[model samples]
Target: MQRWLTYQKERFPLLAHFPLVLLTSWCVLSFASPEPVKIGTLLLVTLLILGLFFQLRVFDEFKDYEEDKTYRPYRAVPRGLITLRELRNVGLFVAGFQLTATYSWNYPSLTLLLVCWIYMVLMGKEFFNPEWLKKQPLLYMLSHLPIVALIQMYAASFVWDLDFPPATWVLALVSLSGGALLEYGRKIRPPEKEEHGVQTYSALWGIPRALMTWFLAGSFGVFALGFAGGGWWVLSVFYGLMFPYALISALRKSALWLKFVELFSAIWIVLMYLALARFP
Candidate 1:
Protein backbone atom coordinates (compact mmCIF):
# COMPACT_ATOMS: atom_id res chain seq x y z
CA MET A 1 0.00 0.00 0.00
CA GLN A 2 2.78 2.40 0.92
CA ARG A 3 4.62 1.58 -2.28
CA TRP A 4 1.52 2.25 -4.35
CA LEU A 5 1.01 5.58 -2.61
CA THR A 6 4.65 6.43 -3.21
CA TYR A 7 4.31 5.50 -6.87
CA GLN A 8 1.33 7.87 -7.20
CA LYS A 9 3.23 10.66 -5.47
CA GLU A 10 6.15 10.19 -7.80
CA ARG A 11 3.86 10.97 -10.68
CA PHE A 12 0.98 13.03 -9.20
CA PRO A 13 2.17 14.58 -5.91
CA LEU A 14 -1.19 15.18 -4.23
CA LEU A 15 -0.18 18.06 -1.94
CA ALA A 16 1.20 20.06 -4.83
CA HIS A 17 -1.54 18.95 -7.20
CA PHE A 18 -4.80 19.19 -5.28
CA PRO A 19 -4.97 22.95 -4.71
CA LEU A 20 -4.25 23.69 -8.34
CA VAL A 21 -6.91 21.28 -9.58
CA LEU A 22 -9.42 22.55 -7.02
CA LEU A 23 -8.81 26.14 -7.92
CA THR A 24 -9.09 25.40 -11.64
CA SER A 25 -12.43 23.78 -10.98
CA TRP A 26 -13.41 26.77 -8.89
CA CYS A 27 -12.45 29.09 -11.72
CA VAL A 28 -14.75 27.21 -14.04
CA LEU A 29 -17.47 27.51 -11.47
CA SER A 30 -16.96 31.25 -11.30
CA PHE A 31 -16.95 31.57 -15.08
CA ALA A 32 -20.17 29.62 -15.59
CA SER A 33 -22.11 30.71 -12.56
CA PRO A 34 -22.52 34.20 -11.16
CA GLU A 35 -24.43 32.89 -8.22
CA PRO A 36 -22.60 31.28 -5.36
CA VAL A 37 -21.40 27.82 -6.36
CA LYS A 38 -22.94 25.07 -4.34
CA ILE A 39 -20.57 23.41 -1.90
CA GLY A 40 -21.69 19.98 -3.01
CA THR A 41 -20.93 20.80 -6.64
CA LEU A 42 -17.50 22.07 -5.67
CA LEU A 43 -16.63 18.90 -3.78
CA LEU A 44 -17.80 16.55 -6.50
CA VAL A 45 -16.17 18.37 -9.42
CA THR A 46 -12.86 18.79 -7.58
CA LEU A 47 -12.69 15.09 -6.80
CA LEU A 48 -13.57 14.24 -10.39
CA ILE A 49 -10.83 16.49 -11.76
CA LEU A 50 -8.23 15.05 -9.38
CA GLY A 51 -9.29 11.50 -10.21
CA LEU A 52 -9.12 12.20 -13.91
CA PHE A 53 -5.65 13.68 -13.57
CA PHE A 54 -4.51 10.51 -11.78
CA GLN A 55 -6.14 8.44 -14.47
CA LEU A 56 -4.23 10.45 -17.07
CA ARG A 57 -0.97 9.76 -15.24
CA VAL A 58 -1.81 6.07 -15.18
CA PHE A 59 -2.49 6.18 -18.90
CA ASP A 60 0.99 7.57 -19.39
CA GLU A 61 2.33 4.66 -17.35
CA PHE A 62 0.46 2.12 -19.43
CA LYS A 63 1.39 3.82 -22.67
CA ASP A 64 5.04 4.06 -21.73
CA TYR A 65 5.53 0.82 -19.79
CA GLU A 66 7.71 -0.77 -22.43
CA GLU A 67 9.61 2.41 -23.14
CA ASP A 68 10.41 2.81 -19.46
CA LYS A 69 11.59 -0.76 -19.25
CA THR A 70 13.99 -0.32 -22.15
CA TYR A 71 15.41 3.19 -21.88
CA ARG A 72 14.23 4.39 -18.46
CA PRO A 73 14.70 1.37 -16.26
CA TYR A 74 15.14 3.53 -13.18
CA ARG A 75 11.56 4.76 -13.29
CA ALA A 76 9.17 3.51 -10.60
CA VAL A 77 7.30 1.11 -12.85
CA PRO A 78 10.40 -0.25 -14.55
CA ARG A 79 12.24 -0.56 -11.24
CA GLY A 80 9.44 -2.73 -9.88
CA LEU A 81 8.33 -0.32 -7.17
CA ILE A 82 4.96 -1.04 -8.70
CA THR A 83 3.64 -3.19 -11.50
CA LEU A 84 1.95 -2.21 -14.79
CA ARG A 85 -0.97 -4.48 -14.00
CA GLU A 86 -1.51 -2.80 -10.64
CA LEU A 87 -1.61 0.67 -12.16
CA ARG A 88 -3.98 -0.56 -14.88
CA ASN A 89 -6.38 -1.95 -12.32
CA VAL A 90 -6.24 1.30 -10.36
CA GLY A 91 -6.88 3.27 -13.54
CA LEU A 92 -9.99 1.24 -14.27
CA PHE A 93 -11.18 1.70 -10.72
CA VAL A 94 -10.68 5.47 -10.83
CA ALA A 95 -12.57 5.68 -14.13
CA GLY A 96 -15.44 3.72 -12.68
CA PHE A 97 -15.61 6.02 -9.67
CA GLN A 98 -15.50 9.07 -11.90
CA LEU A 99 -18.45 7.76 -13.92
CA THR A 100 -20.40 6.95 -10.78
CA ALA A 101 -19.79 10.35 -9.15
CA THR A 102 -20.63 12.23 -12.34
CA TYR A 103 -24.12 10.75 -12.49
CA SER A 104 -24.85 10.55 -8.80
CA TRP A 105 -26.01 14.15 -8.73
CA ASN A 106 -27.15 14.86 -12.27
CA TYR A 107 -27.47 12.25 -15.01
CA PRO A 108 -26.76 14.80 -17.77
CA SER A 109 -23.32 15.36 -16.26
CA LEU A 110 -22.47 11.93 -17.56
CA THR A 111 -22.28 13.31 -21.09
CA LEU A 112 -19.23 15.47 -20.40
CA LEU A 113 -17.61 12.78 -18.24
CA LEU A 114 -17.98 10.28 -21.07
CA VAL A 115 -16.54 12.78 -23.50
CA CYS A 116 -13.47 13.13 -21.28
CA TRP A 117 -13.28 9.35 -20.81
CA ILE A 118 -13.48 8.62 -24.53
CA TYR A 119 -10.81 11.19 -25.26
CA MET A 120 -8.62 9.69 -22.53
CA VAL A 121 -8.99 6.25 -24.10
CA LEU A 122 -7.99 7.58 -27.49
CA MET A 123 -5.06 9.37 -25.90
CA GLY A 124 -4.03 6.13 -24.16
CA LYS A 125 -4.00 4.55 -27.60
CA GLU A 126 -1.95 7.50 -28.86
CA PHE A 127 -4.47 7.73 -31.71
CA PHE A 128 -3.10 4.37 -32.97
CA ASN A 129 0.33 5.71 -34.02
CA PRO A 130 2.59 6.58 -31.12
CA GLU A 131 5.93 6.53 -32.89
CA TRP A 132 4.74 8.58 -35.85
CA LEU A 133 2.99 11.11 -33.63
CA LYS A 134 5.98 11.43 -31.28
CA LYS A 135 8.00 12.78 -34.18
CA GLN A 136 5.42 15.54 -34.70
CA PRO A 137 5.63 17.69 -31.56
CA LEU A 138 3.10 20.18 -32.80
CA LEU A 139 0.50 17.50 -33.46
CA TYR A 140 1.39 15.42 -30.42
CA MET A 141 0.97 18.24 -27.89
CA LEU A 142 -2.05 19.85 -29.51
CA SER A 143 -3.75 16.47 -29.65
CA HIS A 144 -3.17 15.58 -26.00
CA LEU A 145 -3.69 18.96 -24.32
CA PRO A 146 -7.32 19.47 -25.34
CA ILE A 147 -8.27 17.25 -22.45
CA VAL A 148 -7.63 20.22 -20.15
CA ALA A 149 -10.30 22.18 -21.97
CA LEU A 150 -12.64 19.19 -21.73
CA ILE A 151 -12.08 18.98 -17.99
CA GLN A 152 -12.78 22.70 -17.69
CA MET A 153 -16.06 22.22 -19.54
CA TYR A 154 -16.99 19.39 -17.23
CA ALA A 155 -16.30 21.63 -14.23
CA ALA A 156 -18.40 24.43 -15.64
CA SER A 157 -21.32 22.11 -16.31
CA PHE A 158 -21.51 21.21 -12.64
CA VAL A 159 -22.64 24.78 -11.94
CA TRP A 160 -23.99 25.97 -15.31
CA ASP A 161 -27.52 24.59 -14.87
CA LEU A 162 -28.09 25.18 -18.61
CA ASP A 163 -26.92 23.73 -21.87
CA PHE A 164 -23.33 24.67 -22.61
CA PRO A 165 -22.86 26.86 -25.65
CA PRO A 166 -20.19 26.48 -28.29
CA ALA A 167 -19.56 30.24 -28.33
CA THR A 168 -18.59 30.52 -24.68
CA TRP A 169 -16.32 27.55 -25.17
CA VAL A 170 -13.43 29.84 -26.10
CA LEU A 171 -13.18 30.90 -22.48
CA ALA A 172 -11.85 27.46 -21.69
CA LEU A 173 -8.69 28.42 -23.58
CA VAL A 174 -7.62 30.73 -20.78
CA SER A 175 -7.14 27.71 -18.57
CA LEU A 176 -5.90 25.73 -21.55
CA SER A 177 -2.99 28.12 -21.73
CA GLY A 178 -2.43 27.43 -18.05
CA GLY A 179 -2.09 23.76 -18.97
CA ALA A 180 0.41 24.72 -21.68
CA LEU A 181 2.46 26.57 -19.11
CA LEU A 182 2.81 23.34 -17.13
CA GLU A 183 3.29 21.17 -20.20
CA TYR A 184 6.16 23.21 -21.57
CA GLY A 185 7.70 24.07 -18.24
CA ARG A 186 7.64 20.55 -16.80
CA LYS A 187 9.27 19.08 -19.92
CA ILE A 188 12.08 21.68 -19.76
CA ARG A 189 14.54 19.57 -17.81
CA PRO A 190 18.22 20.25 -17.16
CA PRO A 191 21.04 18.64 -19.14
CA GLU A 192 21.56 15.71 -16.76
CA LYS A 193 17.84 14.94 -16.48
CA GLU A 194 17.33 14.70 -20.22
CA GLU A 195 16.72 11.13 -21.40
CA HIS A 196 17.61 9.69 -24.79
CA GLY A 197 14.18 8.57 -25.99
CA VAL A 198 12.21 11.01 -23.84
CA GLN A 199 11.12 14.13 -25.69
CA THR A 200 11.81 17.22 -23.65
CA TYR A 201 10.91 20.53 -25.25
CA SER A 202 14.41 21.74 -24.47
CA ALA A 203 15.80 18.74 -26.37
CA LEU A 204 13.48 19.20 -29.32
CA TRP A 205 13.84 22.97 -29.69
CA GLY A 206 17.12 23.56 -27.85
CA ILE A 207 17.37 25.19 -24.41
CA PRO A 208 17.09 28.85 -25.37
CA ARG A 209 14.18 28.21 -27.67
CA ALA A 210 12.46 26.00 -25.12
CA LEU A 211 12.69 28.69 -22.44
CA MET A 212 11.51 31.25 -24.99
CA THR A 213 8.56 28.96 -25.62
CA TRP A 214 7.80 28.83 -21.89
CA PHE A 215 7.96 32.60 -21.63
CA LEU A 216 5.65 33.08 -24.59
CA ALA A 217 3.22 30.49 -23.33
CA GLY A 218 3.18 32.18 -19.90
CA SER A 219 2.56 35.53 -21.58
CA PHE A 220 -0.34 34.09 -23.56
CA GLY A 221 -1.79 32.60 -20.41
CA VAL A 222 -1.79 35.98 -18.70
CA PHE A 223 -3.24 37.57 -21.81
CA ALA A 224 -6.03 35.03 -21.92
CA LEU A 225 -6.81 35.67 -18.26
CA GLY A 226 -6.74 39.42 -18.67
CA PHE A 227 -8.75 39.24 -21.89
CA ALA A 228 -11.35 37.19 -20.09
CA GLY A 229 -11.26 39.82 -17.33
CA GLY A 230 -10.31 37.35 -14.64
CA GLY A 231 -7.88 39.08 -12.29
CA TRP A 232 -4.93 36.74 -11.89
CA TRP A 233 -2.87 39.26 -9.98
CA VAL A 234 -0.19 36.82 -8.87
CA LEU A 235 0.11 35.35 -12.34
CA SER A 236 0.17 38.81 -13.87
CA VAL A 237 2.73 40.14 -11.43
CA PHE A 238 4.87 37.00 -11.31
CA TYR A 239 5.08 36.96 -15.06
CA GLY A 240 5.68 40.68 -14.95
CA LEU A 241 8.65 40.50 -12.61
CA MET A 242 10.02 37.23 -13.89
CA PHE A 243 9.73 37.89 -17.62
CA PRO A 244 13.28 39.17 -17.81
CA TYR A 245 14.64 36.42 -15.58
CA ALA A 246 12.64 33.77 -17.41
CA LEU A 247 14.32 34.88 -20.61
CA ILE A 248 17.76 34.96 -19.01
CA SER A 249 17.22 31.56 -17.50
CA ALA A 250 16.13 30.17 -20.82
CA LEU A 251 18.98 31.88 -22.58
CA ARG A 252 21.67 31.07 -20.01
CA LYS A 253 20.15 27.98 -18.41
CA SER A 254 20.90 29.65 -15.12
CA ALA A 255 20.26 28.27 -11.63
CA LEU A 256 17.52 30.85 -11.04
CA TRP A 257 15.30 29.39 -13.73
CA LEU A 258 16.11 25.83 -12.82
CA LYS A 259 15.16 26.44 -9.20
CA PHE A 260 11.96 28.16 -10.26
CA VAL A 261 11.01 25.80 -13.07
CA GLU A 262 9.87 22.95 -10.83
CA LEU A 263 7.24 24.93 -8.93
CA PHE A 264 6.52 27.78 -11.37
CA SER A 265 3.93 25.81 -13.32
CA ALA A 266 1.89 24.90 -10.24
CA ILE A 267 2.12 28.43 -8.89
CA TRP A 268 0.86 29.88 -12.15
CA ILE A 269 -2.07 27.50 -12.20
CA VAL A 270 -3.01 28.07 -8.55
CA LEU A 271 -2.88 31.82 -8.94
CA MET A 272 -4.71 31.66 -12.24
CA TYR A 273 -7.73 29.96 -10.79
CA LEU A 274 -7.65 31.95 -7.56
CA ALA A 275 -7.91 35.05 -9.70
CA LEU A 276 -10.86 33.56 -11.53
CA ALA A 277 -12.65 32.70 -8.34
CA ARG A 278 -11.84 36.15 -6.92
CA PHE A 279 -13.08 37.98 -9.97
CA PRO A 280 -16.04 35.75 -10.56
Candidate 2:
Protein backbone atom coordinates (compact mmCIF):
# COMPACT_ATOMS: atom_id res chain seq x y z
CA MET A 1 0.00 0.00 0.00
CA GLN A 2 2.77 2.39 0.86
CA ARG A 3 4.56 1.61 -2.38
CA TRP A 4 1.39 2.09 -4.39
CA LEU A 5 0.78 5.42 -2.68
CA THR A 6 4.28 6.53 -3.56
CA TYR A 7 3.81 5.52 -7.16
CA GLN A 8 0.56 7.46 -7.42
CA LYS A 9 2.11 10.57 -5.94
CA GLU A 10 5.11 10.43 -8.22
CA ARG A 11 3.11 9.67 -11.34
CA PHE A 12 -0.06 11.72 -11.04
CA PRO A 13 1.03 14.64 -8.85
CA LEU A 14 -1.16 17.32 -7.26
CA LEU A 15 -1.75 18.97 -10.61
CA ALA A 16 -4.26 16.22 -11.36
CA HIS A 17 -6.43 17.32 -8.43
CA PHE A 18 -7.17 20.72 -9.96
CA PRO A 19 -9.61 19.44 -12.54
CA LEU A 20 -11.49 17.37 -10.01
CA VAL A 21 -11.76 20.30 -7.67
CA LEU A 22 -12.91 22.61 -10.40
CA LEU A 23 -15.46 20.16 -11.72
CA THR A 24 -16.85 19.23 -8.33
CA SER A 25 -17.11 22.86 -7.26
CA TRP A 26 -18.91 23.74 -10.45
CA CYS A 27 -21.33 20.90 -9.89
CA VAL A 28 -22.11 22.01 -6.34
CA LEU A 29 -22.46 25.65 -7.32
CA SER A 30 -24.80 24.86 -10.15
CA PHE A 31 -26.97 22.88 -7.78
CA ALA A 32 -27.14 25.74 -5.29
CA SER A 33 -28.22 28.33 -7.80
CA PRO A 34 -31.62 29.53 -9.05
CA GLU A 35 -32.45 26.19 -10.63
CA PRO A 36 -31.40 23.57 -8.17
CA VAL A 37 -31.14 19.89 -9.05
CA LYS A 38 -30.79 16.75 -7.01
CA ILE A 39 -27.16 16.42 -6.03
CA GLY A 40 -27.26 13.22 -3.99
CA THR A 41 -26.36 11.15 -6.98
CA LEU A 42 -24.13 13.80 -8.52
CA LEU A 43 -21.61 13.63 -5.69
CA LEU A 44 -21.19 9.89 -6.08
CA VAL A 45 -20.91 10.25 -9.83
CA THR A 46 -18.16 12.85 -9.39
CA LEU A 47 -16.25 10.50 -7.13
CA LEU A 48 -16.34 7.82 -9.81
CA ILE A 49 -15.15 10.31 -12.39
CA LEU A 50 -12.28 11.32 -10.16
CA GLY A 51 -11.34 7.71 -9.58
CA LEU A 52 -11.28 7.12 -13.32
CA PHE A 53 -9.23 10.25 -13.72
CA PHE A 54 -6.55 8.85 -11.45
CA GLN A 55 -6.58 5.48 -13.11
CA LEU A 56 -6.14 7.13 -16.51
CA ARG A 57 -3.08 8.88 -15.16
CA VAL A 58 -1.55 5.49 -14.63
CA PHE A 59 -2.29 4.62 -18.22
CA ASP A 60 -0.74 7.91 -19.26
CA GLU A 61 2.38 7.14 -17.29
CA PHE A 62 2.69 3.86 -19.14
CA LYS A 63 1.84 5.31 -22.54
CA ASP A 64 4.39 8.08 -22.25
CA TYR A 65 7.03 5.78 -20.77
CA GLU A 66 9.41 6.19 -23.68
CA GLU A 67 9.01 9.94 -24.09
CA ASP A 68 9.20 10.33 -20.33
CA LYS A 69 12.50 8.48 -20.19
CA THR A 70 14.00 11.02 -22.50
CA TYR A 71 12.38 14.22 -21.25
CA ARG A 72 10.67 13.48 -17.95
CA PRO A 73 12.96 11.02 -16.30
CA TYR A 74 11.63 11.84 -12.85
CA ARG A 75 8.23 10.45 -13.85
CA ALA A 76 7.24 7.31 -11.95
CA VAL A 77 6.91 4.98 -14.96
CA PRO A 78 10.47 5.29 -16.14
CA ARG A 79 11.81 5.52 -12.63
CA GLY A 80 10.60 1.93 -12.14
CA LEU A 81 8.07 2.73 -9.49
CA ILE A 82 5.21 0.89 -11.21
CA THR A 83 4.68 -1.73 -13.88
CA LEU A 84 2.72 -1.56 -17.12
CA ARG A 85 0.63 -4.58 -16.21
CA GLU A 86 -0.37 -3.01 -12.93
CA LEU A 87 -1.42 0.12 -14.76
CA ARG A 88 -3.42 -1.92 -17.21
CA ASN A 89 -5.31 -3.68 -14.46
CA VAL A 90 -5.99 -0.44 -12.66
CA GLY A 91 -7.17 1.25 -15.82
CA LEU A 92 -9.59 -1.56 -16.59
CA PHE A 93 -10.97 -1.56 -13.08
CA VAL A 94 -11.43 2.21 -13.08
CA ALA A 95 -13.12 2.15 -16.45
CA GLY A 96 -15.54 -0.48 -15.26
CA PHE A 97 -16.27 1.43 -12.06
CA GLN A 98 -16.82 4.66 -13.99
CA LEU A 99 -19.34 2.99 -16.25
CA THR A 100 -21.14 1.27 -13.42
CA ALA A 101 -21.32 4.46 -11.38
CA THR A 102 -22.62 6.53 -14.24
CA TYR A 103 -25.18 3.96 -15.18
CA SER A 104 -26.50 4.09 -11.64
CA TRP A 105 -27.03 7.85 -11.80
CA ASN A 106 -29.46 8.04 -14.77
CA TYR A 107 -29.39 9.52 -18.30
CA PRO A 108 -27.38 12.56 -17.17
CA SER A 109 -24.69 10.29 -15.86
CA LEU A 110 -24.74 8.36 -19.11
CA THR A 111 -24.01 11.54 -21.04
CA LEU A 112 -21.20 12.34 -18.66
CA LEU A 113 -19.87 8.84 -19.07
CA LEU A 114 -19.55 9.33 -22.83
CA VAL A 115 -17.86 12.69 -22.40
CA CYS A 116 -15.40 11.38 -19.85
CA TRP A 117 -14.57 8.40 -22.03
CA ILE A 118 -13.78 10.71 -24.92
CA TYR A 119 -11.47 12.75 -22.71
CA MET A 120 -9.58 9.64 -21.70
CA VAL A 121 -9.31 8.64 -25.35
CA LEU A 122 -7.98 12.07 -26.25
CA MET A 123 -5.37 11.88 -23.53
CA GLY A 124 -4.18 8.57 -24.95
CA LYS A 125 -3.88 10.04 -28.41
CA GLU A 126 -2.15 13.18 -27.17
CA PHE A 127 0.44 11.22 -25.25
CA PHE A 128 1.09 8.44 -27.75
CA ASN A 129 0.82 10.09 -31.14
CA PRO A 130 2.22 13.49 -30.49
CA GLU A 131 2.73 13.37 -34.22
CA TRP A 132 -1.00 13.22 -34.93
CA LEU A 133 -2.47 16.16 -32.93
CA LYS A 134 0.34 17.23 -30.61
CA LYS A 135 2.64 17.81 -33.54
CA GLN A 136 0.43 20.71 -34.53
CA PRO A 137 0.79 23.33 -31.77
CA LEU A 138 -2.47 25.16 -32.44
CA LEU A 139 -4.48 21.98 -32.64
CA TYR A 140 -2.77 20.65 -29.55
CA MET A 141 -3.70 23.76 -27.65
CA LEU A 142 -7.31 23.50 -28.79
CA SER A 143 -7.51 19.88 -27.71
CA HIS A 144 -8.13 20.61 -24.03
CA LEU A 145 -10.96 23.07 -24.62
CA PRO A 146 -13.61 20.45 -25.10
CA ILE A 147 -12.80 18.65 -21.88
CA VAL A 148 -12.83 21.82 -19.80
CA ALA A 149 -16.02 23.12 -21.35
CA LEU A 150 -17.67 19.79 -20.90
CA ILE A 151 -17.05 20.03 -17.18
CA GLN A 152 -19.18 23.14 -16.91
CA MET A 153 -21.67 21.86 -19.43
CA TYR A 154 -22.20 18.66 -17.46
CA ALA A 155 -22.67 20.62 -14.26
CA ALA A 156 -25.13 23.06 -15.83
CA SER A 157 -27.09 20.29 -17.41
CA PHE A 158 -27.24 18.14 -14.30
CA VAL A 159 -28.15 20.96 -11.95
CA TRP A 160 -30.44 23.18 -13.95
CA ASP A 161 -31.33 20.64 -16.61
CA LEU A 162 -31.06 23.64 -18.89
CA ASP A 163 -29.03 24.03 -22.03
CA PHE A 164 -25.73 25.60 -21.11
CA PRO A 165 -25.89 29.36 -21.36
CA PRO A 166 -23.94 31.28 -24.00
CA ALA A 167 -21.58 32.28 -21.24
CA THR A 168 -20.45 28.68 -20.97
CA TRP A 169 -19.40 28.79 -24.62
CA VAL A 170 -17.39 31.94 -23.95
CA LEU A 171 -15.78 30.25 -20.95
CA ALA A 172 -14.80 27.31 -23.13
CA LEU A 173 -13.18 29.64 -25.66
CA VAL A 174 -11.33 31.38 -22.85
CA SER A 175 -10.01 28.03 -21.63
CA LEU A 176 -8.91 27.14 -25.16
CA SER A 177 -6.97 30.39 -25.60
CA GLY A 178 -5.23 30.05 -22.23
CA GLY A 179 -4.30 26.46 -23.00
CA ALA A 180 -2.80 27.61 -26.31
CA LEU A 181 -0.79 30.39 -24.67
CA LEU A 182 0.68 28.08 -22.05
CA GLU A 183 1.68 25.53 -24.64
CA TYR A 184 3.21 28.28 -26.76
CA GLY A 185 5.17 29.56 -23.78
CA ARG A 186 6.57 26.10 -23.01
CA LYS A 187 7.67 25.72 -26.62
CA ILE A 188 10.36 28.38 -26.15
CA ARG A 189 11.99 26.95 -23.05
CA PRO A 190 15.79 26.73 -23.49
CA PRO A 191 15.61 27.56 -27.17
CA GLU A 192 19.07 26.20 -27.84
CA LYS A 193 18.13 22.71 -26.70
CA GLU A 194 16.09 21.82 -29.76
CA GLU A 195 18.00 18.55 -30.00
CA HIS A 196 15.94 17.25 -27.09
CA GLY A 197 13.49 14.48 -28.02
CA VAL A 198 10.34 16.38 -27.15
CA GLN A 199 8.87 18.40 -29.98
CA THR A 200 7.19 21.56 -28.67
CA TYR A 201 5.46 24.59 -30.14
CA SER A 202 8.23 26.94 -29.02
CA ALA A 203 10.71 24.68 -30.82
CA LEU A 204 8.69 25.04 -34.01
CA TRP A 205 7.71 28.71 -33.66
CA GLY A 206 10.69 30.27 -31.80
CA ILE A 207 10.56 32.29 -28.57
CA PRO A 208 9.61 35.75 -29.79
CA ARG A 209 6.82 34.46 -31.99
CA ALA A 210 5.60 32.11 -29.30
CA LEU A 211 5.55 34.95 -26.80
CA MET A 212 3.46 37.03 -29.20
CA THR A 213 1.03 34.19 -29.63
CA TRP A 214 0.85 33.63 -25.88
CA PHE A 215 0.14 37.29 -25.20
CA LEU A 216 -2.57 37.51 -27.82
CA ALA A 217 -4.16 34.31 -26.60
CA GLY A 218 -4.04 35.48 -22.97
CA SER A 219 -5.50 38.87 -23.88
CA PHE A 220 -8.39 37.35 -25.76
CA GLY A 221 -9.16 34.95 -22.89
CA VAL A 222 -9.30 37.74 -20.32
CA PHE A 223 -11.60 39.84 -22.48
CA ALA A 224 -13.76 36.88 -23.33
CA LEU A 225 -14.28 35.87 -19.71
CA GLY A 226 -14.62 39.45 -18.53
CA PHE A 227 -17.54 40.19 -20.80
CA ALA A 228 -19.10 36.79 -20.38
CA GLY A 229 -20.48 37.73 -16.97
CA GLY A 230 -21.98 40.94 -18.29
CA GLY A 231 -19.32 43.33 -17.04
CA TRP A 232 -19.37 42.76 -13.31
CA TRP A 233 -16.64 45.42 -13.38
CA VAL A 234 -14.77 43.93 -10.38
CA LEU A 235 -14.47 40.50 -11.86
CA SER A 236 -13.44 42.04 -15.17
CA VAL A 237 -10.64 43.88 -13.43
CA PHE A 238 -9.59 40.69 -11.67
CA TYR A 239 -9.41 38.87 -14.98
CA GLY A 240 -7.18 41.57 -16.50
CA LEU A 241 -4.76 41.25 -13.62
CA MET A 242 -3.48 37.95 -15.01
CA PHE A 243 -1.78 39.58 -18.04
CA PRO A 244 0.89 41.59 -16.24
CA TYR A 245 2.07 38.54 -14.29
CA ALA A 246 2.18 36.45 -17.46
CA LEU A 247 4.23 39.18 -19.10
CA ILE A 248 6.66 39.31 -16.22
CA SER A 249 7.01 35.56 -16.40
CA ALA A 250 7.82 35.98 -20.09
CA LEU A 251 10.43 38.68 -19.43
CA ARG A 252 12.16 36.69 -16.69
CA LYS A 253 12.11 33.41 -18.64
CA SER A 254 10.42 31.53 -15.82
CA ALA A 255 7.99 28.62 -16.05
CA LEU A 256 6.95 29.22 -12.45
CA TRP A 257 5.21 32.35 -13.67
CA LEU A 258 3.18 30.15 -15.93
CA LYS A 259 1.88 28.38 -12.82
CA PHE A 260 0.62 31.73 -11.60
CA VAL A 261 -1.08 32.30 -14.91
CA GLU A 262 -2.80 28.94 -14.64
CA LEU A 263 -3.99 29.68 -11.12
CA PHE A 264 -5.42 33.03 -12.11
CA SER A 265 -6.98 31.53 -15.17
CA ALA A 266 -8.81 28.97 -13.07
CA ILE A 267 -9.94 31.56 -10.56
CA TRP A 268 -11.52 33.58 -13.35
CA ILE A 269 -14.07 30.89 -14.01
CA VAL A 270 -15.01 30.60 -10.35
CA LEU A 271 -15.30 34.36 -10.11
CA MET A 272 -17.41 34.53 -13.23
CA TYR A 273 -19.86 32.08 -11.75
CA LEU A 274 -19.97 33.99 -8.50
CA ALA A 275 -20.48 37.28 -10.31
CA LEU A 276 -23.34 35.87 -12.29
CA ALA A 277 -24.97 34.37 -9.22
CA ARG A 278 -25.46 37.91 -7.98
CA PHE A 279 -28.16 38.36 -10.61
CA PRO A 280 -31.37 36.22 -10.80
Q: Model 1: per-residue lDDT, tens digit, 180-246?
A: 8888877887676688988888888877887777767666656666666665456646667657766
Candidate 2 off by > 4 Å: 14-24, 27-33, 36-42, 126-132, 160-168, 174-195, 199-212, 218-222, 234-240, 254-280
Index of the highest-TM-score prediction:
1
Candidate 2 least-lDDT 10 residues: 271-280
Q: What are the TM-scores, per candidate, against the unseen true structure?
A: 0.91, 0.72
For residue 272, model 1's alpha carbon misses the true position, in angstroms, by 2.3
Candidate models: Cα lDDT each: 0.77, 0.58
Q: Residue 87 in candidate 2 has what lDDT?
A: 82
Candidate 2 residue-wise lDDT, 123-230, digit = tens: 777745677775576776676556645654554455434455545655455545544544554455544445567776556775445555666765665566456554
- The lDDT of model 2 is 0.58
